[model samples]
Target: MATRFLIEGRVQGVGYRNWLQEEARRRGLRGTVRNLSDGRVEAVIIGSYEETDAMLAACRKGPPLAKVSGIGLDPIDDPDVSGFIVLRDY
Candidate 1:
């Protein structure tokens, strides 16, 4: 399964993407995380239901520096991706 997360609030300059990458990798999830031009962080997580849910939970808290006011989740019908990656800013 694949889900896209748009994380907002103090996420842009707080190493949110890198931190999310580590979290995803630690959970054995495969996909990408990037910073959006609008100051939010975006992550595409592809994994089992449990893994995806776990990632979403972590995103709610985010890194220590991130305020994480809101997290927007969208179900995606995309092909599965391999490995977790830190993508260029979107």
Candidate 2:
């Protein structure tokens, strides 16, 4: 199963996506993370249940500059994603 997350708070301009990319890679996850115009960071990570859980845990703290306030999870029907990328700002 694929898991998508919408993280709201002080996420943009804080290297949150970049940090997430690194951490996701470290955990061998496949997905993308991007910034939303509504001042949120969104990510879709496809991996084992344990790895996805770890990714969510990391998202709670985020980078040193990020002040994460909330995280919303949604399970998607799509197949596992490919590589991880920092998508263009939305």
Candidate 3:
């Protein structure tokens, strides 16, 4: 199973995406992180349930510069990500 998340609040321009990419890679997760024009960071991480949960916990705190307000999580039917990458703004 894959886990997708939409992280809201003080996410963009704060290295949140970059940090998420690194963290996901470190956890050996296949996923992508991107910045939304609505000032949210969206990510899809695919890994074991435990690893995905850990990633979500980390997203809740984010990087030092990030002020994460909320994290919305959902199970994805198909998250066909190859590897962790930082995607262009959507």
Please provide, for model 1 over 6-80, each residue's C-alpha lDDT reduced to its tens digit, 9 standing for 90 to 100. 988999888888899999998888999888899988899999899999888989998898899998999998656
Candidate 1 lDDT (Cα, whole model)? 0.89
Best lDDT among the predictions, by candidate number: 2
- Residue pair clashes in candidate 1: none
**Candidate 3 segments whose C-alpha is farther than 4 A from its true place:** none
Give per-residue CA lDDT, model 2, range 1-90, as digits (tens).
589999999999988999999999988889989999899999998988898998999999999999999999999875556788888989
Candidate 3 lDDT for residue 68: 88
Error of 3 at 13 (Å): 0.7
TM-score, candidate number 1: 0.93
lDDT of each: 0.89, 0.90, 0.88
lDDT per residue as tens, model 3, 1-90 = 687799998998888998999999998999888888888888998888889889889999999999988988888876666888888888
TM-scores of all predicted structures: 0.93, 0.94, 0.94
